[model samples]
Target chain A: MDPVLLLDVILLLLAVTTAITAMAIRDLLGSVMLMGIYGLLMAVIWADLFAMDVSFTEASVGAGAATILLLSALTRTGTRERTGGDHHLPALVVVLITGSVLIHGTSQMPAFGDPQAPAHIHVAPHYLSQDIGKVSQKSSDGATRRDFGDHVPNTVTAVLTAYRGYDTMFETVVIFSAGVCLVLLLRPRSPLRREQADE
Target chain B: MNIDGHLIAALLVLIGAILSMIRAAAGPTSYDRVLAVNVFGTKAVMLLAIIGFIGDRSGFLDIAILYGLVNFIATVALLRFVETKRLT
Candidate 1:
C-alpha cells in the first residue's frame, strides 16, 4: 500500500478506536482525554489529505477550544460517570443502519480527486482561472474598464469570501453567537462578590 | 517500490501517535492518560510538518504551528484540571 494512504488508514482507524472508547469508558476524565486524542488524530488526517485550511480549523477548534471547553464542563460535573444499564444493542443497530446508508450513498459520488468531476467542470474552473489575475471589472456602461488587480491566488479563501460570501457570513455569525453563549454560561464568578456575601 | 523519506518520517510519527493513543485509552492513572494525549499531540505536529514537506506546500507548516500552540494550551489546561477541581 502507498505510504500516505497507509498513514490515512492508520489515523482513521485510531480515530474510530478512540471515539468508541471515549463513548464506552466509565471514567469521564479518561473519556474526555480520549476525545482529545481523537481530535488530534483527525487534524493529522486532514493535513495528510492536503486540506490545510480545514486542518488548521480542526487543530485550533477541535483539539484546542473544544478540549478546554469540555474540561471546564467536567470541572463543574464530577469526573466519574454514573453507572447506567448497558443498552448497546439498539444503538448498535441504529449505527449500523446509518453507516450502511451513508456507504451506499457514496457509490453515486465521484472518485476522490477526480479532475472530471461535476464540481470541477462548473464554476470551479472559472474560480481557479482567476489566479492568473485576468479578472476585469466592468464600468457603468458595460465596457470592461480596469483589470481587477491580482485576483486572490488562494482558491479556498476566494471561494469562502467571494463566491460564497453569504454562507461564510452566516457561519461567522453562528460562531460568534456560540462564543457569546459560552461566555454567558461559563463566566468566572466574582471572588469579591462571594467574599462580601459571606461577610 | 520507491519510498519517500518524508512518508517514512510521517509513518514513524504515526506509529508513535498510535502508541500514545493506546496509553491514553487504557492508562491506569488520569495523569498517564493526560500525558499520552499530550504526546499524541506532539506526534501529530511532527506528522503534519513531515507531510507538508512531502506535499511541497508551505501552508501545512502553518497548521503544524497551530497544533503545537494548541497542544501546549490544552496540556496545561488538562494538568490544571487534574490538580485543581476548578478551571478558574
Candidate 2:
C-alpha cells in the first residue's frame, strides 16, 4: 500500500479510539482534559486532510476557549458522579440501525477527488476561473466574469458575510438571547423583599 | 487504505473522545457532565474540520468557524449560569 493511504487508515483508527475513550472515562475533570486533547488531535487530523481553515477554528475554539469555560463551570459545581439507570435497549437498537444506514449511504459517495461531483463542478470552478466584477459579463472569448463589487478570494468569507448575511445576523441575536437568559436565570433572589413579604 | 501519520493522529483523537464520553457518562456531578459535554463539542468541531479536509471541501471551514464560536459562547454562558446557581 502507498504510504499516504496507510497514513489515512492510521488516522481513522486513532479518531475512533479517541471517541471511544472519551465516552468511557470516569473522572469528569480528567475527561474534560482528555476532550481538549481530542480537539487538538482533531485539529491535526484536519491539517493532515488539508483543511487549514477548519484546523484554525477548531484549535482556537475547541481546544482553547471551550475547555476554559467548561473548567470554570466545574469550579462552580463540585465534581461528583451520579448514578443512572441502564442503557435503554430500544435506543441502542435505533442508533445501530441509523449507523448502518449511514455506512451504507457512504458507499455510494463520489471518491475523494473524482473531479466530476456536483460540489466540484458547479461552485468552485466558477469562483476560481472568473474575476470579480459588478456585471456578470462574458469576455470576447466566451468566458464568464463574476461580479465581486469588493469581495475577498476566500469563498467561505463571501458566503458567510454576504450570501448568508441574514442567517449570521439571526445567529448573533441568538447569542445575545442566550446571554440574557443566563443573566435572568442566574440572578440572585431578593432576601430583604422576601422577609418583608413574610411580615 | 494504507496506514500513516494522519491516521495515527486520528486514532489519538478518537481515543481522547472516547475517554471524554466515558467521563460524561459517569460524572457524579452536573458540572462534570457539563465539562464532558464541552469536551465533546470541541472534539466534534475538530472532527467536522477533518472531514471537510478529507472531502476536499474547504468551503465547509466557514461552518466550522461558526460552530466553534457558538460552542465557546455556549460554554461561557453555561459556566456563568452555574456560578449563579451555586451562589443562590
Candidate 3:
C-alpha cells in the first residue's frame, strides 16, 4: 500500500476506535473530550480527501467550537453517565444494522479521486474550464477552450462564492440562526435560574 | 510503500495520539482526561502540518494553525467551565 493510503487507514482506524470508546465510556466528560479528538481526526481525513474547504470548516467549527459547547454543557449537566441499562440486545442490533448500511452505501460510490466518476464527469469539467481571471487553453482553430490556469487558483472558493453562492449564503444563515437560537434558549431570564445550585 | 522521514514523523505523531487516547480513556480524574485530550489536540496540529507537506498543499497549514489556536481556546474554555460551573 502507498504510504499515504497507510496513513489514511491508520487515521481512520484511530477515529473509529476513539468513537466507539467514547460511546462505551461511563464518564460523559471523557466521552466529550474523545469526541473532540474524533473531530480532529475526521478533519485530517477530509484534508487527505482533498476537500480543503471542508477540512478547514471541520477543524475550526466542528472540532473547536463544538468541543467548547459540549464542555460548557457538561458543566451544567453532571459528568457521570448513569450506569448501563438492561436492554443491550436491541441497541446492539440497531448499531450493527446502521454500521453495515453505512458501509454498503459508501461501497456503491466511486472510489476516491476516480477522475471518470459521475461527479467528476459532471460540473467539475465546467469548473475546470471556466476561468474568470484567465483563459487556460484555446484550440488550435481558436474555437474551443480547455485550460484555465490563470483563474482564481483556488476554485473551491470561487465555486462556493460564485456558482454555489446560494448554498454558502444559506449555510451562513444557518450558522447565524444557530447562534440566535442558542441565545434565545440559553440566556437566563429568571433570577432563580441565574444561580445554578450544584447538583 | 517506502518508509522515509516524513512518513515516519507522521506515524510517530499518530502513535502519540494513540497514547493520549489511552490516557484520556483510563485517567482517574476528569482533569487528567482533559489534559490528555489537549495533548492529543496538539499532536493533531503537528500531524496536520506533516500531512499538508506530504500532500503539497499549503492550505493544510492554515487548518493546522487554526487547530492550534482553537485547541488552546477550547482547553481554556473547558477549564473555566469546569472550575466555575458557569460561563460568563
Candidate 4:
C-alpha cells in the first residue's frame, strides 16, 4: 500500500475513534480532551490530504481555540456530565443513513487532483495561471486585448485576498462576533448588581 | 511499495500517537489525560513535518510551526485549568 494512503487511513480512523470516545465518555473533562485529540487527528488528516491551509486552520482553531473555550466553559459548568438515558438507537440510525448518503454522493465526484475535473475547467485554470491580474478588454472593432498581469507568484494568497476577499472578510467578521459574544456572555457581573442584591 | 525512512518514522510516530490516545481515553486521572494530550499534540507536529517533507511542499513547514505554537499554548492553558480549576 502507498505510505501516504496508509497514513491518511490511519489518521481518519483515529479521528473517528476519538470523536466517538469523546461523545461516549461520561467525564466532561475527558470528553473535552478527547475532542482536542480528535481535532489534532483531523488536522493531520487535512495535512495528509495536501490541504495545508485547511490543516493550519484546523490545528489552530479546531485543536487550540476550541479546547481552550471548552475548558473555560467546563470551569463554569462543572466537569461531571449528568447521566442521561442510554437509548441512542434513533440517533445511530440517523447518523448511519447520513454517512451512507454522503459516501454515495462522493462516488460521482472526480478523482482527487484530476486536471480534467469540472472544477478545474472554469475559473480554476485562470487562478492557477500567470494571467490572474490581467483583464481582457474588447475594442470597438471587436478586437480583444489582454492587459499585463501583475504576476502574483502565490496563487493561493491571491485567490484568498483578491478574488475571494469579501468571503474571507465575512468569515473574519463572523469569528469576531463570536468572540465578542463569548466575552459578553462570560464577563464578570457588575458591582452595581451585587450591591443591589445585597440591599 | 518499498518503505522508506520517512515512512518508517511516520509509522513509529503514529504508533506513539495511538498509544497516547489510548492513555488519554483510559485515563485514571485528569493529569494522565492532560499529559497524554500533550504528547499527542507533539506527535501531531512531528507527523506534519514528516508528511510535509514526504510531499515536497515546503510551505507545510509554516503550518507545522503554527501548529507547534498553538499546541504549546493549548497545553499550557489546559495545565493551568487542571491546576487551578479556573480559566481566568
lDDT winner: 4
Off by over 4 Å in 1: A88-96, A110-162, A187-199, B1-3
| DockQ metric, candidate 4 | 0.77
Could you give the candidate ranking by TM-score, starting with the highest? Answer: 4, 1, 3, 2
Candidate 4 lDDT over A21-131, as tens digits, reads 998899999998898888888988998998877988898889999999999888878889888767789899999999999999999999999989998798776777645
Collision pairs in model 3 = A136-A147, A136-A148
Per-residue lDDT for A92-176 in model 2, tens only? 9999999999999999999998889878898776665444334676878998765564345576654454457689789799989
lDDT tens readout by residue for model 3, A16-45: 998999999998878888888888888888
Quote the lDDT for A21 in model 4: 94
> In model 2, which regions exceed 4 Å deviation?
A1-12, A76-78, A83-85, A110-131, A134-199, B1-88
True contacts kept of each: 0.89, 0.04, 0.71, 0.85
User: Could you tell me the lDDT of residue A153 within candidate 3?
Assistant: 66
How high is the lDDT of residue A84 in model 2? 69
Each prediction's TM-score versus the true structure: 0.78, 0.51, 0.78, 0.79
Q: Which clashing pairs does model 1 show?
A: none
Off by more than 4 A, model 3 = A88-162, A192-199, B1-3
DockQ of 1: 0.78
DockQ for every model comes to: 0.78, 0.10, 0.67, 0.77
Q: What interface RMSD does every candidate have?
A: 1.3, 8.6, 1.5, 1.2
Best by TM-score: 4
